[model samples]
Target chain A: MARVVVDVMLKPEILDPQGQAVQRALPRLGFEGIADVRQGKRFELEVEGPVDDAALARIHEMAETFLANTVIEDFEVKVETSEGPK
Target chain B: MTARPSPTATLNGGPTGRWNVRIGVVTFPGTLDDRDTQRAVRIAGAEAVPLWHRDKDLKQVDAVVLPGGFSYGDYLRAGAISRFSPLMETIIDQAKAGMPVLGICNGFQVLTESHLLPGAMLRNNHLHFICRDQKLRVESTSTAWTADYTAGQEISIPLKNIDGRYVADERTLDLLEAEGRVAFRYLDGNPNGSLRDIAGITNEAGNVVGLMPHPEHAVEPLVGTGRTDGLGFFTSILKKLVNA
Candidate 1:
């Protein structure tokens, strides 16, 4: 089994209106303890295949090309043997 | 008897010489819909040319399209940084010369940022990233990019963005209304707190148009919403080119 992790974020310089809205609303909801809030999506996929470096690279490419907009977001992937000690 | 090829086929290079309508799709650093926009242009029987933000020339394309996507990651504001791209300078000149230009979502933001269109995009009133099938009424059929649509014709398109709300000074809004420059109006409900449910607008010359919807994504019948309402935008330009 192989694992892929994907993260999506608005570009740093971009104004995140959604994040700002949540930050302003937090205090009103009695969550005054929160200082900052940035919203993003995270996805993890488990694939069944021969876990290899080539396969890991393909997964990363797919994420960058379609899953995540590299201009505003970046992602990292990890692959490991699903079972047993080496 | 030999069968004659359809005019469209001949124009698009079937038996006759190449008649592809060359369209340039501008890609800003954070643009998200450049590829999809190119595909849609191809489907509309036009040749799609990929244009870079740094390029000063428009590559001799007949028309230009600014695809939706966060340019410069929507830095400072949506389409703010992208408005300064070298390509926009050429587009501004070409648009003044009556070249048809269409802007979608983030592209719309860029048009506004460049002052190619009036009004500004602000944070949505609900203040959330909205992705939905939105209904819009075509208010003007005079724009080069909207000629195929009928006035008051309601169509559905995909709208997605955090700062998609449209805002303008009251006088500007009034002038737009008086001059019939308002190209589209939101129907059903306003997804964003746009003043007067305005969804899109066109320039005074009717050559430049901008809208906060993903018309490219709506062209394919089997896609997300399975609605072809947005296809009219592409067809309109094609018709305009053929007539010209």
Candidate 2:
């Protein structure tokens, strides 16, 4: 089995008020020198068979069509193989 | 161009008596304003048809209204999940073919997600949910839902939402302004930090309009802010359908 991860984020130009609020709170908690902060979503998908180009491409399509709005967000997909009983 | 009759006059049994305009109101999971929207339609002298989100059929209604609420709990993103619902599939097609579609508040979010209108809504600049009586200026009367309102008319309606800030590419904003497609502009103060203070906008064909304010709530005189300024939306569409 293979694990696929998709991370979706707002475009750099768009304003992220939620992320900004978190960043502001961090300063009050004595966390300093953080240049910037942005919040995004991450999705993990488990596949049943060997991961191939076709499978990766389909996952990318899913991310583009459903996981991410594309208008205000960008996404990236990565593959992580499950290593069991190491 | 002939002078248009007042919506009040038409609602009071104008020349066209007992007009049979059927307007469909859609309800998705968590949709809260469908009943109020139906009432607004009936008050404007049109038949209100209830449409379910999972149903592909539109029931032969002349127009559709996507009312306000946190559909699908506004999961993933506001309106993202609901945009792919069966009802929206038909709504998108009909909207493209010039059938009137009015999206209010969360409905506006759905329209944007469906790509029937441009831009995406973001969280309010202050990161808080705001609810109040909002003043807006009617910027265009060419759309199917704004014909009853004169340009530059200022009216107050109730607005409540967290994701009400409207954002779009600069080029699209310029085009909307150039073509006079901006249907409503925020007045007195910008409620949610929307770009250009835009409260609502219509599509290029003037058949689709999406706004963040709740016009249905303002249609009754004794309830919800006690101003019927929002009744014009229903009356405007009825006038367009009857004349068409």
Candidate 3:
């Protein structure tokens, strides 16, 4: 069995208004020196038994096609088992 | 070309007689605008067919309208999950085969998610849900929708959505422009920070269009902001069906 996580984030070139609103408010709360902030989503999936190379590839495909809108977002999959999130 | 007649002019009778077209309005669980869309279709002199998101068949409607609303609670991004609904599978195939499909607001997000249209929608540049009577210029009259208005004619409709800013790669934007796929664009002011001031666009075949505004809300003088700028979209589809 393997547990994996996928992080989906808007591409750097894309504008993130939510992150910007938060970034602007931080200064009012006495927090400074923060250059920027970006918002994203993280999805954790549990796979039952026998993780293999093909399984990893399939997970990557699922992240690209379903878990993320690749046109404007990028996704990274991390295998939390043998690999410490490569 | 001049714009169509006044809204009251069509109030006398939906059409001079019965129209042969049936327009389908899909209702996803969270859809808030299905009734409005059906009303618009009826006002346009067509039979308004009610379609369920869970239903796989399209009911042989001449056209389909995916109305605005928070489908699937706008979870995992607006329109993402709804794009995979059972009905959407049929819609995707039918839309690709040149069936007329108009997606408004959240519906627009679904069209993009399903790859029936290019580009994606992001949060409004101000990171808020913006609701307003937005002014838009008709950039193309060749699509399944928008044929009732002349190119460059400006109209106002209710624009409401949280994730409504349109984004696409430069190449795609340029291609859309070159191909005249930009069916509608913001006029007066760019309300949502959309690229190129685009408010709506069409597929390559022009049978599918996706926009961030609710044209359904503007089809009548008695409801919504009392402006009738959106009647053209509904009427335009009927015109196409008649001509086909």
Candidate closest to the true structure, highest DockQ: 3
> Which scores higher on lDDT, 1 or 3?
3
Give the alpha carbon lDDT tens digit for every residue of A1-86 in model 2.
78898999999999988898888888799999886889999998998787899999889998988899999999999888578435
Q: Is candidate 1 or candidate 3 better by DockQ?
A: 3
Q: Write the per-residue lDDT of candidate 3 for residues B1-244, one digit (tens) a residue.
A: 1221121222223355566677889999999999989999989888899999999887777789999999999989899999999999988888877788999999999999998999999988977778889988899998989889998998889998888899999999999999999989998888889999999999999999999988899977888879899999999998888766
Candidate 1 has what TM-score?
A: 0.72
Q: Give each candidate's interface RMSD in Å.
A: 8.9, 0.7, 0.6
Q: For candidate 1, lDDT tens digit of each residue in B66-153?
A: 9998888886568877877888877887787778899999999888877788877877877779999999999999998888888899
- What is the lDDT, from 0 to 100, of the residue B115 in candidate 1? 79
Give lDDT per model, in order: 0.81, 0.90, 0.88
Could you give the candidate ranking by TM-score, starting with the highest? Answer: 2, 3, 1
Off by over 4 Å in 1: A1-86, B1-18
Interface RMSD of candidate number 3: 0.6
- The value of fnat for model 1 is 0.25
* Colliding pairs, model 1: B32-B69
Q: Which is superior by TM-score, 1 or 3? A: 3
Collision count of model 2: 0
Docking class of 2: medium
Better of 2 and 3 by TM-score: 2
DockQ of each: 0.11, 0.76, 0.82
